[model samples]
Target: MDDGNVSLDRMRTFVRVAQRGSLSAAARELGIGQSTVTRHINELEEALGVSLLGRTTRRVTLTEEGSQYHANCLQILRLVEQATEEARDARRVPVGVVRVSCTSALGVMHLARIIFAFQDEHPDIRIDLNLTDERIDLAREGVDVALRLGPVMDDAMKLVAIGASGRRLAGSRDYLASRGRPARPAELTNHNSIVMSNVAGSEHLLLSAPDGTRLMVPVSGTLRVDHGLAARAALAAGRGIAPAHLWLIQDLLDAGKLETVLDEYDLDAVPVSLLVVPERAGIARVRLLVDFLVDEIRKLPGITPHRSASG
Candidate 1:
């Protein structure tokens, strides 16, 4: 090995040159002189006592040893970078546009409240929320953070399960009075069920009978909407009985407009998750938002029991 002094900058030059396949292109990318890039690569190769690059008029090529050395260099550099990023303030809590993606229902129903609360904690940050019912590709969409209902299948992003909400049957006192109170889960089949359309395609609801026989009923109604808020409103209007998030109907229920049905049956719970691409979540503005939102979600009335406790 040629005993020569090498710096991080020279290693960077070598990597850049190898990537571009030419010193001129690497120099252009680095905004440095071509001669300087060549010097740095030469110096790095001399220091390692290995031929890192074979220079030609047309392009640069790597030898067998150079290929292995390049991989090691990249890994080492990445490790050092990650450590540096952790030590530095990722600048996560300041004011900036954080692009957030979520389903239209959640973004419209719950995201606004959380965003307001998060903004109160971080006044500088501005949230750009994109609402969609369809699945969005985070990388293609260029979203910084996303609030999702239920589990995420993609492992490319990190997921934090903030909390969950369950579907509950609700209807107005008038609607119940008009249709008559259902005596059992089997009775639901005879009544009008305000099914949420997106969920109707699947069998997510559980129904149990008087004889202790559990039946999973795939329900339907004349009135079905995608949004939870709309379903709650429809129920309050005595339009039809609907399945909804309990928190969304609390005020309506409190006002005696809506009543819960089939409480005895075991219903499936929907998970709320925070999906963040590493680049943004690792930064300050996004980090603060994720943390704040998680805290608020935990305190949500639907998920938490209302009891005497210390703050």
Candidate 2:
């Protein structure tokens, strides 16, 4: 028997036999005939010139030599599998589906455009966009990446901080015209505001001045809503003033439907981040999409890009 005759198949069969301790059981596990398993074991032993197994009518046990060889075989098989996967990943094309999760308002108002542009660039890559505000389990829901606002609490996820999303005090032109723009942050108390009930401390407004002065002003509203789109609609309807993310209302501001009130006062910014599943982060399509999203998101009007953060 030649050393070259020790094939991977034979080693696998031998390992299976060593694990199962029965030729018939190994055959069943390998989806092969018992004779085939026997031949592999015999050939493996013959090639090595060692009695690898002690056999009886009921069961087979690994010899000391077999025990050592089984350990080596396991290591070799694992290495082979890892190498194969690495090679495949290295050569994989930027194709296939990338499942993305984002908040509803951001998805509809901004992210949807970015996604459409991405698809146009990578015609082969398909997108499954899940627009929801819920913090979903990425692994359980099979999400490749998630774009979220605020802090991402999942330590298991790989995070890429796109930026801090800046907000401004804004209201529709008609509303500001009727109610009058607040000349100072304190004057906001006299104006009707559209508050986002979902945000923490929505009842109060925090503003920072260029002179390093911070003000905490209590705010009240006739209409308090939980979603961005609703707040936007109310603002467009000349409802009241509210702190709005720049990306959410940039178009309205451009069209003169909305105007920034108290532009000198800056509102607190929220962290915008991309959370990727650790396993999927290595895939060609997912990586490409994530990179594209980061670049695009950084270009948004009120985004202040930050140093990358990963876990």
Candidate 3:
């Protein structure tokens, strides 16, 4: 059997038959006659010089080799379908649903607006936005693109560095007034603090000083929160001081409800990144949204733009 005789049509027919477990069922699914399905399978086996299917009068089953071949065929067919869609989309207007994910806080505060604006521009494009703080599997969850905050540990996904999300120590004006503002980082221990339980190190704060000095200040608080919106509410209600991503509290700061504490000190900036599924990266709609998101994200206040890099 010559390997050159193997064809995608044969592989697809084999996969369908393997999945359906019957030649008749596979033929029906493929809109072909059962005889055609039988011929395709026979051709595949003859070309490969291996018996792929265990045929029976009632049902069919895959041999060990067939199972491996089926898995590979699934991947190949998916890639081919994707490539076809991308090519077709390139010739037409960018139109389709693009699934997007973002941290809840950022989504509510900024990304929602960006997405809405994008939909307005590309009226044919629709967005399915998933908002959560939990790190999720993009491929498993069917997310086309995601705005990820902090370190993106997965080097598998294509990552574009949007910028560093600068954080600031801040509290409500009322809280600062009632408790008295801490003049230094160490003095934060005396104040009632609002801790973000979702962050890695909630018990301690690492701050950089104007003099290029860095210090790790241990902190404790009565109010421990996981969600950024909850922490923002606690801050607005004058619960306590907490380190916040500037975008998180920018509205309150503008409204004079919150004030930056220890302006001379800085917290380590979190990396703001856009993650794209490698397969979806070529789709016209996905590419449009990704480019739009990156452009708009750069304009966000408190986010420092840097050279974009892919991992």
Candidate 4:
């Protein structure tokens, strides 16, 4: 078939009809009349010289050749759409709805503020922020970007390192005064520990000494919480010592509301990263949001921006 004879609109219509199983349903989704939908399918079949759909009064079914063509059509349509979006994005004015997913603690403590500030700067872009601790399937959920702590779990995602957040053992001033500070990591067993259930390895505190020696101390507490914010609140209220992100509790630590414990040991930094769906990575809004986050998140207290290994 000549390239000029094939229509992108017809391909889209056929794919939609294949998915919806009815011309009326595809027409409704496309905001076109049923007659136009039928015309598109007929034109598409004529161009390809094959019947793409077996139509019945009840539903539409694909023939064997139609099934193969449908798959190819879906990929072709996606590429065309992506190309169009890329052309539009070349203008550099990010103008679209970007859906973002992040943990509740990070969203409430820092991400929310950053998003609002970003929205103010780019008034044309709309942000839909979903805050939850549950792990989300970005593709399934239609999330453009995700801000996550620790390592990127999905290898399929494009990972951009935002920064490094180090956790430090902290306790309220009153709690420290009443319970007495532990002279060594081994002594932590005696004090009440505010365990964060959400954090991995919360049951044990990993401490490293100045000489590069590491110690894994078993910890238990009366108060255990699943959320990071709740755990921080408990630690700040003189409950017990817990490993808290420096960015989250820096203000309290500076104000003497909380004091750092076992200062001699250097704790490793947990990498904070932004995950973008591979297909969405080329979108202007997603790229802009990622760069914005990389710049702004580094500005937060105690957050060290991650550098590439070559850098």
TM-score of 4: 0.74
Clashing pairs in 3: none
Q: Comparing candidate 1 with candidate 3, which one achieves the higher TM-score?
A: 3
Which candidate achieves the best lDDT against the true structure? 3
The global Cα lDDT (0 to 1) of model 3 is: 0.87
Structure candidate 2, residue pairs in collision = none
Clash-forming residue pairs, model 4: none
The C-alpha TM-scores of every prediction are: 0.65, 0.70, 0.75, 0.74
TM-score winner between 1 and 2, please give it: 2
On lDDT, the stronger of 1 and 3 is: 3
| C-alpha lDDT of all candidate models, in order | 0.73, 0.86, 0.87, 0.85
Q: Write the residue-wise lDDT of candidate 2 on 1-311 in tens digits.
A: 68875988898888789877899999997999999998888888989999999999999998999988887886675456445545656776566678899999999988999999999989988898999978887764557799999988999899888889999889998888888879998898999989888888989998998797999999997899989999999999999999999999999999999999888888888999999977677777778899999999988979988865331
**Residue ranges of candidate 4 with Cα displaced over 4 Å:** 1-81, 309-311
Candidate 2, which segments miss by more than 4 Å at Cα? 1-90, 307-311
- lDDT (Cα, tens digit) per residue for candidate 1, span 1-311: 54554777886777777766888988997899999997888778778888888878899988888878776666565556545545555443365567788877566767788898888877877887888877776754556788777667979898777667766777889989988987677677777877777764542457554566767765667876877667767888898766677657777778787888878764556777778977556766768788777777666546642123122
lDDT of 4 by residue, 152-183 (tens): 77998898887788888899999999999999
* Model 3: per-residue Cα lDDT over 199-225, one tens digit each: 888889999999999999988889999
